[model samples]
Target: MPKPEHPTDPDVEISASATARELRFHARPEVTVHAEAEPGGECAWGSDRTNLPDQVEPNVTYRDIRIDFRVAAALTDPTQDPSSP
Candidate 1:
């Protein structure tokens, strides 16, 4: 196999970032990423932000989705125990 050109470990100022581009979500989502890099030294860094819809509708299909939840009768209640997961 051909060797990769760039370091997998992102720990330099001379780098680039790309995320959340051309994406559509029916509901708000938790975005999680882990990056290790230093800013400003001898190189340039470019950044792009999360992409949201250009337009939205209220009380329509474009509204944010919600999830309904309730405690099941058969579930063992853990509210009383702080150590419980």
Candidate 2:
């Protein structure tokens, strides 16, 4: 006896309001990250962008080398936060 085969079909799915955080990119030699609680609210330092590649690679996938959510006393304090990260 032989098993029966079924026809395969492509399935489509859509997503809305993904839970993942979006990465912000910059082409400048240096970058500073900041986040605000709300409009006109206190702003805080997010992270320091450094050791950036001189040139972006083509047709190749990239990932963040390091991500530090560990906020410092100054970074956490909006009043003491610097204009740049």
Top of the candidates by TM-score: 1
lDDT of 2 by residue, 1-85 (tens): 1111211121211112212233334433354544333322333222322332435444433454333332212113446545767
The parts of candidate 1 lying over 4 Å away from their true place are 1-22, 37-46, 50-85
What TM-score, computed on C-alpha atoms, does each candidate reach? 0.22, 0.21
Residue 66 of model 1: what lDDT? Answer: 27
Weakest 10 consecutive residues, lDDT, candidate 2? 1-10
Candidate lDDT (C-alpha), each: 0.31, 0.31
TM-score, candidate number 2: 0.21
Across residues 11-44, which tens digit of lDDT does each residue of candidate 1 receive?
3323333333234446555544343322221222
lDDT of 1 at 67: 22
